[model samples]
Target: MNKAMICFLLLLSSPVIAQKQKTVDSKINHVTVFLSRAQIEREVRTQVEAGKTDLIITGLTSQLDQQSIQVAGKGNFIILGITHQQNYLSELNTPRSLRILKDSVEFFQKQLLIEQSQKEILNKEEQMLLSNQKIGGTNQNLTVAELKGMADFYRTRLGEIVIARMKHDDKIKKINERLTKVQQQIQTQNELYTRNTSEIVVSISADAPATVQLDVNYIVANAGWQPLYDLRALNTKAPVQLNYKANVYQSTGEEWKNVKLKLSTANPNQGGLKPELYAWYLDFDQPIYRGLQGKASGVRIKSAAPAMAMDKEEDAMEPPAETTADFVSTVQTSLNTVFDIALPYTVSSSNKPTLVDIRKQELKSDYLYSVAPKLDADAFLMARIVGWEELSLLPGEANVFFEGTFVTKTFIDPNNIKDTLSISLGRDKRIVVKREKLKDFSSRKAIGSKQSDSYAYAISVRNAKTEAIKIIVEDQVPVSQNTQIEVTATELNNANYTQETGKLIWEMTVQPNETRKVVYKFDVKYPKGKIIPAL
Candidate 1:
């Protein structure tokens, strides 16, 4: 019994064998970029000997989400578990481009140091000469010719020293400028120059010597894409050309070199609208000695379509869109959209915008000049786009170009339910518009218990272009909210008037070098004691 116990104790105290560890390098093969984050997928292949092998995948960015790490492999091995940690002793490997930038910064810094050192030496020499300027050490036995020769020597040397000092200072200034530029380049690139090291360790068990291929993916932060557009109109009669684009960027340290990219509109960082509720047991407040008994009831909400705040822009989900001709294939799912880019792209680790062309479309539009003379004398050219919603576009700022000239910027809002999208193409100074009050028709009178005020205005629009143009002129009258106040339009000049809004609209076509004028009058009557501010 004593020998058996001794053998068991020795067996329990023995050290367990450690697993063989191996460092594996992975290549980024695919990336799916969202509106605020990105998912990176990599392919790792390595050989594993028989037994438990620990594979450490290195070179990931510090902005990676540890909870999103997932690994799957194909071989005669079973994945036991996975863990993530930082290798504090070492950092990420420097890429060639960033190393070049660092070398440039170092070179400039060295040159600056040399120039500054030269300047300092020259200053010290000048100071030393100036402090020792007691000719012949205060002795009167020195000859005048010797003194004069010494003076000449001192003057020439001092002048040369000044010139040399100025030259050195100038060189230092130039070197400093170069140094600042290179440093800014490094900061602006914002690539894999971080000092933190990230590693994902995977524990696996294998039967025999086998080669394993790993499919590893994880979600990373500080990577996203935004919508950008360019709207161009070559002529008033031609269709508007819409160029949809995206500015994709990522600051995740690993560079995606020649990888497949798919843009997604879904943001994983945001919580979903659907929430689950479990059954709850309700009981009255009481101290009971018996077993607790209650009825269970709960509201089992659906997986989607929960109650949300009535923010039209955020809540109006996009319907299906007709896929058109483009290099990207749009796949619409229930919650979000996926745009598969056809070509392999090389998006650097630098957080700089890389312009990606989404698609180009020619949209049908109607152009009309809009003049609000009462507000401003400028007649704006407006374009009513017909079918912009079918493109599955987001609300983004657009650069407007009219007649091959760059105009002002406009925003395309997809939230509105209007069938046509209205965008201002800019003002047409060639079409002059003017509005003036008619003093002859303006008067104020009081009769009985009411006071009446009459006002009139005249507006003129001149078409100076070579072709005819259609314009919509707008004006308004006073709107009365009180029962004692009465507002009437005396003359509308054949304009369409809406009584509810007191708006007057005139649609007309003006030929080249033609002028059109309209005069309208209105009267407002209110109680004698009440004041009408709008009048």
Candidate 2:
């Protein structure tokens, strides 16, 4: 074929191109929430022709982080470009609720028009009565009967006009009142509409005729989930039931309906950078010289070493036949733990918190009574659990319950080196504890040029409960840092004593209504004329 003929033939054989822009709407299907942020995932499906086409997804949250937006597809279409734009078009100014209010205002406005017309008619009728005020013409005399009849006619007509005018006035008043209320409602609606920013406009294109499913994901601020726990200890011998939950809250202007929710412990707001330590050194200052005029003169000295930079810092379920159970799936990563809720949930854009059950576990705990006698005479009931790290627990506030009663509130921190989680289940009132100073054994005496001081304390623990209890009493002795002073724990009532921290711990089993006494004596030998603190 010739060149022109070949071009015509190629054009005839080419496929027809149909390029059209289509706006697609998406719904939130999944959300993975962090400590103070969340990842929102929305999906939409549509069909496209065998040419380049634009797919615009609208109605997204305005609190979306533009840099965190990600677009993915599962079809033959390829996303050419994606962008976010906020449009304040007049049509968007009226939300659904406000539209209803406007419709009401229009109805009231029509009533107002009728009321105004009625009022104008009343005014015109009154004016006409005033214009006809002449009772008799200036031409001739009238009979008495005729004059009396004219007066009666004027009285009746004037009375009817006044009554009709009053009714019109009342109707106008009511219409004005209705109008005022609608206006106020509109104002309040407008005030609430300030958060309505334009929707997200995504630019997508397709290559061939196919069904494309696009998934849009973005991070939203002002949304978060916090871990909460209810720790219930029925009895000392029974296992503790730990009901784990999350308080999810958000005000990101997007309501997640029937969406899969996942709570995470990852904090994206805190940047992942370990602060470095810089060497800090001090240099000797050179002596300054005084000037002849009695003025001080000093040379600006620079440090020999570089200056150190200051671093800135669930649910319960019922059993049924052939039932399908739903529970939150716990996933742990290197940095965070996730609780994926299997059931769908609806989370509104209000600041109110929605509590969701994550998981519940019956944990075996060792119950013990602990008392810091030097600080308080009350003994606290404590529970220690091992293998809690596998539970994927986070640091949060926990509510303690014992024997079907509210005990206290405590904090649960999972980051521990001992690998055992310890919780204080409030004070044990049945256990009485007291610490007394033994004055006879504690005295100071002078030996040559040195003073020898002996101090002793006795801790008593009495268990008044029906069952026997194990109590740990903790006290501390003075530890000296100077060579001139000598301190020693002369007598430790069969208790474990640590010389480094001068901590004395007494572990004893006290029978019911039995008192156990622990006595510890410490002697301090220091040079004369020296003061000993906390003696």
Candidate 3:
């Protein structure tokens, strides 16, 4: 062939090539999950020439919130434009562990086949032994020794066959156990690998031939965190140990494996629009006309009548202390606070909550035993914590533990404006309380056109515990809403009284085995024709 012919053949023999854009797969390296939303962050590292390239990143969960998608590039690349698309055609790639599980399943299947073949051989041998129990017809005339030998042979063979069959059955059982485990692993992996993925097509313009690292961030729904707490106090003098934690749940279809996780208290799902008050409008009620059954009779109305005498006794109707010392280490920003977990975690897409420890703090508090005899006969143990606002705690359920024992659960609301946070730990069974009416000081009489009723009550408290304790005794006096009726606290017995809420507080220290008494008197005067619902 001539040189021109040879050159043409060489060009023709060369492989046909087409221009294609650079594509790379980026993984979720970090996640900042909020109370109601999660922000996924990924980084792509690749070398790009001095030209334009389209980087197609796949393997993102389909539950991504499209509007929150953001893309940025580092190094010598400029991010031109970005777009998101659902890629149902993307293949679900199994992880290394899943691949290993597949191998394990194949191995177990092979073992099962071998075990079944052995079992079939054993069955055939057993059948042959059972069939050979009868000898030829000529052997019937044999001697006693010969017949005994034949019987012995039959017995030995049958026993051996039974033992072999049992051994085969045991092997089969063990194989089945392994097979069951392998099948379960396969099923779990299959479920995890069955989800479709999303793609982020990022248009990039490279400044030069260099490695460009692209950071992709997006928000996904159905992933969030909530606060949890454990409060434990050993004694009244010791500080309380508070452990703050977060329970995170996600079902975003992509497992976050060994990723840096952060929990935020900000809720993006909350209404962002400022609330506007509407005009309050009221109107008079409109009457409705209805026929009574088939008759057009008017509805009868009942009228209230004055009581002639004392009515019979009616049936009884059945009815955060803040620590400022970093309960959880938080990174406060302009909009939200974040808790960056120190340890990496793998939060699967199973929607099961995974608890992560935020921080622990020993908070100083005052312990008080309080009794509200008017409402409940039991005395409760409470802890008043001051300067709790420094902890930056969000409202959450707290599990209270006293003296190494789990007492009860109480909610801690940080929005409360009280200077001191009062937490009711649990009921104090060591303090006995009783409230009874003082019959000698109680009287009911009528003067002219008005009726007056006076009542006195005594509250007795005893400290049965061996140690001294701080206690607060509480009671209430009624208030009159009608102008014609008058109500007064005739004798408060030096108790701190608040007129706004009608609550009387008696704070005192009780010694061991000490008994204390509180007395209060109240009187109500109303018109003779009017009735007071409660006295």
TM-score result, candidate 2: 0.70
For candidate 1, the TM-score is: 0.79
Q: What local distance difference test score does each model get?
A: 0.83, 0.77, 0.79
**Candidate 2: tens digits of C-alpha lDDT, residues 219-299:** 888899888999999988988888888889987767677998788877767645555454455557854443233223221
lDDT of 3 by residue, 69-141 (tens): 8777778677888888898987456667778988987887888888788878878987888877766585457
Estimated TM-score per prediction?
Answer: 0.79, 0.70, 0.74
Task: Arrange candidates, best lDDT first.
Answer: 1, 3, 2
Q: List the candidate 1 regions with Cα displacement exceeding 4 Å.
A: 1-15, 116-159, 184-192, 275-326, 349-352, 438-443, 490-494, 512-519
- Tell me how candidate 1 scores on lDDT: 0.83
Q: Which is the winner by TM-score between candidate 1 and candidate 3?
A: 1
Cα lDDT, model 3, residue 195: 76
At residue 375, what lDDT does model 1 achieve?
87
Q: Write the per-residue lDDT of candidate 1 for residues 273-372, one digit (tens) a residue.
A: 4545445655689544444343432211111222222111233678434322245666666777777776678887775778877777789999999989
Q: Point out the higher-scoring one by TM-score: 2 or 3.
A: 3
* Top candidate (lDDT): 1
Write out the backbone clash pairs for model 1: none
